[model samples]
Target: MAFGTGNQIRTAGRFIRSVFLGPQLAAFLPAVMLGAYWFGGEGVLLVAAVILPALIAFAGLASRGLDLRSPRDSVTGLPGRDHLVRHLDITARATGGNDSQARVGLVIEIDNFRGLQGMYGESGAEAILRQTSERIAGVMRRDDLIASLGNGRFGIAMEKTPRVDLETMIRLSTRLQEAIAAPFSIDGARILVTACVGFALPGRVPDQTGDAYLAAAESALAEAQRSGPASIRAFTRAMRPRVSVPDALTKEVVRALEDGQIRPWFQPQISTDTGALTGFEALARWEHPEKGRIAPGAFLPAIARAGLFERLGEVILFNALTAIREWDRAGLEVPTVAVNFSPDELRNPELFDKLRWELDRFDLAPERLTIEVLEDVVAKSDDDVVTRNIAALSKLGCPIDLDDFGTGHASIANIRRFNVNRIKIDRSFVTRVDTDRDQQNMVAAILTMAERLGLATLGEGVESHGEHAMLSQLGCSHVQGYSIAKPMPFEETGAWIIENQRRICDHPRLPRQAG
Candidate 1:
């Protein structure tokens, strides 16, 4: 069931108390009018009839798209993303395909924005964004289009000018970073922020369409982010990931799933205490016959774009359950296989039953298959079906592992509310836990909290022996990353498990202290 529709909002109370005005509420006008009349008189009923439609109509337009005089972001007072894109398109066309005169498009994404949101609250995050946006806008020319792209991102369309080059983009990116790095004060507390920047030069954006230019910049921005915080990258042909598939990504995703090209690659997770195999996570991989391997990041979006999230989830679930049974047959003693479900799949009213039937069909115990939910889903969920489905899954004995812990809005209350069995410490904190004092302190705090709550903890992205030693000392139950074992196909798991079993060391290998 799509979360965007009424299936998720079956209750009248939820509809009434919903913070955002939705067009679906249009159908409830008659009921609302009757309620108004019951509570008040003809005067109130007349007032409701006149005012409700206007509000709904305005909200509907805003929800669909703001078509009138280009909309501005409420917090930043800058143009919205659409306005920047439109202006970029106009500027690009006015250049008449002349690369020298074409405008540049850049995107600046605030680093760890969600972490800031989680730490300081939404309003604090907004204040940071507002101040940062003003600084960014000030860095650009008065006429150069600047936009608030939401999610701690800003889009910039440079005024069409000649002599645009990589050097110019780099200089401008530096200025933007400087602006973002400036400390922000929210209620007497000073918060420092950094941003990654990506820009596409006019000539690099092939069609010079606003959407294409923006996408190129975003791709570069992704590259910059991958490099590190406060990094900058100019768009290049190589930045775009190549998936050796059909011309259309969406089309290829549909065919790949049907042809069995997309499947699970199991990454082993081990007990940090004993280094014994506890389980493996079933991460999706697309293996093209010609290309050998395709990155999930490249095609997963295509799956979502094609509205195949539910289908993808079904495929992964079946593969995971099958893997668990296979491991059982091989006497591997692998306890469970974790599979992630998209928000759309979690919202399905039939998810609980579907999972039960799948487990039954595979003749596997419910505990043998772990269900992984993103912290974002737990944090932002408003759908009744999602909440009920998660609770039902927990009741049925399947462990729920919240993925990317500490990165999203999931709180202690929400974690308990959703029956989370385990928290996977995000790689951000785990990256330098062995040598970085700050990283060690953060992981220690998270582990302490988890221990207090009696929740199992796993640290992700544990890449070094020292880091593994530190996490073990800090009392993480499990660890998973390249240091343990990179993801492998089902065919390789048997031998890999056998070989890896010999590598298991005793608990407390050494009392290594982290920085």
Candidate 2:
């Protein structure tokens, strides 16, 4: 009867304490009972029930102590900004007390954080952050405090750092940069990480906030990042820009097409051997009402970012075809029209079906239309989407021209893997060919290879008579450049082609100039 009464009392006490102490203490009832039984005292149960919760609370509080003796990271197992601020304060005071040597702050940012998230997904992004934290920690000294400021950014307080000795610190930063650049395998894909580092000395810091040092470092890092990937830079006041436009410009560009602002300009392509007009390539442009004629350089990049490249392609194609038909009706011999296609256009399965329907509506021949594809798009994936699209175009008697060859990682592979009828040498190699022997040799070899493969070659950026003669001798089938004719409006191109036809028939060798 006595044992039953005691057990009942103990059970009642646990329920009351759980209600008063809440969930964290309620978990300790079993341990308290075991401790009470291990000690040979009937009265010890009452003491243990109270003592266990108190001990647990004390241990939790002790774990969170923010004093210097506490663990570098707080109870959250995350290093707090207070740790960084405390170190900076100590270093500033110590170095300020000495009037000669100065303390410098370095802030390192993980370059392309969003890119990693895009390429590797969220879990991979978090893993990269954790690994970066450990790497920064490993490079840190006992006196040099490090703390995570959130995201993939970290701050460092270099104690008693000297301005003249910044070279050694930069070398250490270089090692960190190289370590990040080294390839990492994640989720069956290889990823390369890079960082932009910024540094500051005492008086050179920004805003005088606790994060001033870190901010200065980040500012320098941003300046370094303009060149891209694994770059390091020191912050400068001159590098800060006054205005930062929002990404809403992409939305403005998307609506530009519906607003009748997006249109095409035609550039003429002439036969290299005969200097006769063969075709015109359609290039997109946006005539912004406010900005005044935004080049493809400005708005095309935004269009690409907004994932409207296919829509852009379709608009250009329809406009070009309409222009070609108008020119044909006006008694201009429209030899052929070439339209460039982005990777997105090739991957779109319905691109061909939509194209065929449009061509039929306009009564245009496939032989008179050429599709210009980038060399980079061919090597992006092994999906065979582009190859299949090219084959379908070929079946329709459409000539597939690989544009910007020798510029990307796999230009030669594109020729071997994809069935292309023409190869256009990138302007970079063509412009330098006359001056550089190696460039000339490379262009000659590519031309010879294309010849053996029975593919027509187009040499772009032929600006001089000598260049034209060299390209013709080298067996380039087509030529397009400023010397021939720049990209112009549809009506002007029609007028120019008529004059060239009259001149070519009259005096075959009379080097024709624009009328």
Candidate 3:
């Protein structure tokens, strides 16, 4: 009974400290002063003013590392970014700038969170954030500080411990991803989400400041997101993401998209056995005036945040058709142009009409433009409009090429339902297929499945001649990657096409391996 009473007293003390010393105290301070003036005159009001602030400051000083001045995130009930950074600074200072005593800083951001918010409402998005935070906290130690960094991102500062290292952080990152990626249900909708993780190890950090550590982790997270969904990246000396201010970056993205600075750069896809030009995939690239060439990774998030995905799609589709038409006029026999459509764009009700109009405008066959869709959309999307749009396009003679095939765990039924003509194998399975027996087996299995399903297979990311040869011998119908050709602007494609034809005519195709 005595222990229970002591515990209750401590809890009451914590409540008082949190309320009176937290940022919420600002809300009630004016009222408290007003009441004091009404009841006890000017002297009491002045006394209350000084005493209240001093008391709050004293309460804050009593709780070291808590950072009472730091704000809180209403969505996840975690400390705000300021609090985590403040803790980081305090730790750095206390440890006397010793890397041996420093801790790990992690940032986990849900991939494509804007898409979720666009599909569902803000309330539903908040629910996901809350659940994600809960999962993160459940796996963390009590000493670990978790903060909501806004925009579907969370930050964690782990307590200093010798047990934590690179391998440990990697495992923890994987565990956190697993916890967050488990199916979420909100308002009768089942949502599947994945997160990219970035962490700063003390030993690898060049600078000792709190901002430096946090920025490094954020940079790594940005890099991870570029690799694909659920990817992880650790901080390196060369990684820096988004040096500009938020408002500045947003403005630049808006102008870049509107002023034709952002457009498609085409990459050629070829027949592996014959080295013939089969098609070209239209990829988005941003050409900044002063920055030279900006990677899609650096600006895509800004584009999504600005709600201009559909507009970007319009630009790509237009550019792709223009390229094809230009090639036609130049007598270049580029068979087809492949354009990818995001799930949000695919869900547009007028997508079918828009595609048909674009085809009519270009005076090209529907088969001349291939529609590429991510496998995740096929596996996870339940929207009837997306389904209808894809079906209508397939029926209209636009070949449906499924992008990043093996990553989404898409079933055969989903493939058949969407009428996918070709499945482009993800680079994860194709990275080193020539030397890795396991990769060879995996490619073989996929090829066998594709053959049985009557779906053409294309091995993506063929980087070396050996990988190219292995893919051809595996009976992969087509291949696309840096080995064949990097993405180029329309003007450069003519020269590349001519050069590729000359080279292939002089070289012999690798023969298939007999079973």
The positional error of residue 417 in candidate 1, measured at the CA in angstroms, is: 7.7
Residue-level lDDT tens digits of model 1 in 1-515: 35435545655644563434677777888899999999998999999999988887777665534346777788888778788888888777767557677878899989878777876788998898888888987899876778888889899888767678888778889988988776678898645567899988877777767887888888788777756567798888766542332438799789899888999999999987677899999999888887556666568778877899999988888888888888888888899999998999998999999999998999988899898999989998989999999999999999999999986768889999999999999876786578777677788889888878889999987767877888888888899987777788999999998877777643446553452
lDDT for residue 470 in candidate 1, whole number 0-100: 85
Q: Judge candidate 3 against the unseen true structure and give its global Cα lDDT, from 0 to 1.
A: 0.85
Ordered by TM-score, highest first, the candidates read 3, 1, 2
Report how far off residue 341 is in candidate 3 (Å): 0.3
Indicate the residue-level lDDT of 409 in model 2: 48
Q: How do the residues 1-515 of candidate 3 rate in per-residue lDDT, one tens digit apiece?
A: 67669779988988877876865677799899999999999999989988988877776677764555567788887888888887777676555445567777899999767756755679989999999999999999888999999889999998887665778889999999989967788998656677999998876777677787788898888778756567899988777543444645878888888899999999999998778899999999987887566677568878888888999999999999999899999999999999999877998999999999999999999999999999889989899999999999999999999998876778999999999999999776786689777678888999999999999999987768898999999899899987788788888999998888888877787888786
Across 1-515, the per-residue lDDT of candidate 2 in tens digits comes to 67669779977976665455545755768876877878857678878767767766765554444543534442124465677776666556545533246556777778546545654567887777777776776776666667776557777776564442456767878977766655566776545466877776556554444456555666676566544445677666665521122477799977997776897888888886465788888988776776555546457777878899988987889889998899888888777899998888998888788888888999999877888987767656566776788778878888888887765445566676677888888765565355556556777888878878889989876656666666766667888876677677776887888877776665434242221
Error of 1 at 447 (Å): 1.7
Model 2: which ten-residue window has the lowest total lDDT?
A: 506-515
State which candidate, 2 or 3, has the greater TM-score: 3
Local accuracy by lDDT, each model: 0.82, 0.70, 0.85
The TM-score that candidate 3 achieves is 0.59
Better of 1 and 3 by TM-score: 3
Error of 3 at 366 (Å): 0.7
Q: In model 1, what lDDT does residue 287 have?
A: 85
Q: Per-residue error at 195 for model 3, in Å? A: 17
